[model samples]
Target: MKYWNLKKINQSAFEKTGIVPRSMSKLFNRFKQELNPNAEVEALEEFKVAKYQTSTSIKYIIVLLITPILINQLSKISVLDPLVNHLWNKNSNYIFLNPSQEERAFADLQRFEEKLHFEILIGKLDALSAENVNNKMSNKALAIALEYSQESVNAIKNIIADFISIIIFVSIIITNKRQFSILKSFINELIYGLSDTAKAFLIILFTDIFVGFHSPHGWEIVIEAILRHFGLPESRDFIFIFISTFPVILDTIFKYWIFRYLNKISPSAVATYHNMNE
Candidate 1:
């Protein structure tokens, strides 16, 4: 006996009848399932699905939590570290994380010189010759440079470790299609199973946190931190432009999803969202 693909069968059936919306198709399936003759068999199938989804969720959590630390430890083994250092650290700049760090170092030196001059004017210390002032500034600048260079090296190590972790994550996702599908279904059910009020509350919370009036400040800080983590230049123009465009795009996509999918699947939740929003 040939196994039937119910999904494809449904698609073909719908096409024969006429183009039917997905929401209507889903409702029909739900009604059919409710009226199934083998109710015990349906319950057993649901139990199996729940079991698979739960196991997949646990595996995902373990992999996400442990993979990064395992990869980081593996990267630090004596065998690999020397080769990585030779290949990566050879050309990596040891002076600063980025040009911005150098600029900040100079700015700090300038501020120190200004403070020293102010102290002299106030007679807080004996007057120093220009040669002595130059020597002090040079020493301070060297100290700052050394400190920043060490920070740069540490940042590079972290970046390499994170890159490896990302590769492992992608590999797992690629290899585990069945688990991925189960997890996807689990997440969909988890979200759609919530009460209408719960859905509205979550939607409001997400929107307020991500794209609300107060979100630009949060985005600016996050962008600055990410740039610093990657030793990239924290350009004000780039940050401002991203903040202006990305949130608007995200908000648009979010609204479209609500209108296109959520509105069809759960009209009551959408209505509740609007009422609560008003």
Candidate 2:
């Protein structure tokens, strides 16, 4: 009677939580004696261990190959150049030899439309705000996007120039270990990435800043030379100089600043603590 009562209590407890009692194995054996018997379970422990081992080995090999290339690539950013030397196959694809990329009056405009939708976005953002605060954000973001596009353009064009500069800088470092040590960290920080509008803005802004003015469509080089040689300043009393220089400088500056600005705006942590201080 006591055994039967204990069995009933155990059954009631198991029913409540759906956990089998220790003695349930005996019940299964009894059933198996009367019925058929075949139990099967496949285990995957060995295969899983082998797969994890192979993955770790492959990751180590990849790191060994990539680390040096990444380190070398990080080392050059500034110093001005004559601009003509930065070429891909002496042109950007078909641009240099056949014709020119920026030769068309509205090349940047049309290209931006196709890939970036930049102008349309700016228009929408501007329409969203009545408050001065909201309006400022719209205008600022619009300007930055425009600038980013331009900077990205200049960065690509100047790729050769940057490469040449890197080679020279690296050579200098290799020859003098002491000098190299002074700038190791700086070299690592020198690689620049610019978005399209930002690139355009920097190219425009710098030309304006350096020579002091802006020209999007682009005056002929001969025409610009004639003006600068004859004494034309951007702000006062000079006709051609202001027209020639301002546009390029402003365009360059806008492009670079906007590119950097937008990069910081995204979720990724920026490189320097100075960005935080600002």
Candidate 3:
């Protein structure tokens, strides 16, 4: 608080000192580069796959999405959910499995590296979460640091949502040709962006109005209504999720089909990534 209140930026003094931290300045320059649609890393990282999923391929696109939403719904989940809080704690005070948390995270990520699609998503989320924690866990008070209005926290949340949307949209493109894995970190990402007000509101709304901790799970009631309307049994939660996936799946297909066709028709004008990594 003292530093935040006291540290004033003077335009002339800044010009004289030119004292931007190398690490902070790099991000600004990187963001400027990202304004280019053809930024080198973005192009390299995005690969177009012809065969996305198949009968023989893997099932499950990360069951972990539900976990964060639930963990996030809990009051003061900061103190309640250790793995998640530990995973999400915006500080570096904690260690994992005898190694630095980030190192442990990378090692944990190695298990899925063989699946190229899984590898990429894991890399993105783990790095995102760990970085979010590592940067703010020290010095700042947890309450203020976690405030939704706080820039650093908001940045991580926005990035997580953006990442999930990208993963979903991209997964749609590779439909039925291959199988990919999604990890827990994807959901953990959104927790960063919520404002203290937003989180408090959500905690109240989801608990009291929507889910009602004393009553049946909100998902159950919604599922029951839809299932009964369709003359299906209410017991089959999997059926509901399977059905829900169709829209997102098809939208992805249509989007990527458009992109692929465009690239095929006008490779020079539209294509930037080589479509295969070196």
lDDT of 3 by residue, 1-278 (tens): 32221122111112221244323454697788779877875444322110111111223343224433443334223433444344556664433222222343454444333343454477854434555544543323343323322322323344444455456555554562212222112222233234434444443443344334333455456665554333233345575564456434654664474355423333322222222211
Give candidate 2's error at residue 261 in angstroms.
51
lDDT of each: 0.76, 0.40, 0.38
Return whichever of 2 and 3 wins on TM-score.
3
Ranking by TM-score: 1, 3, 2
Question: By lDDT, who's the top model here?
Answer: 1
RMSD in angstroms between candidate 2 and the native structure over all alpha carbons: 28.2
Q: Go through the candidates in order and give the clash count of each.
A: 0, 49, 13
Candidate 2 lDDT over residue span 185-234, tens digit each: 22222222343344344444445444442233244454444333322222
Q: lDDT by residue for model 1 over 184-239, one digit each (tens)?
A: 66677678778889999999999988999999999999998888777788799999
* Global Cα RMSD, each model: 5.4, 28.2, 28.5
TM-score of model 3 vs. true structure: 0.18
Please provide TM-scores, in order, for all candidate models, with all chains considered together.
0.75, 0.18, 0.18
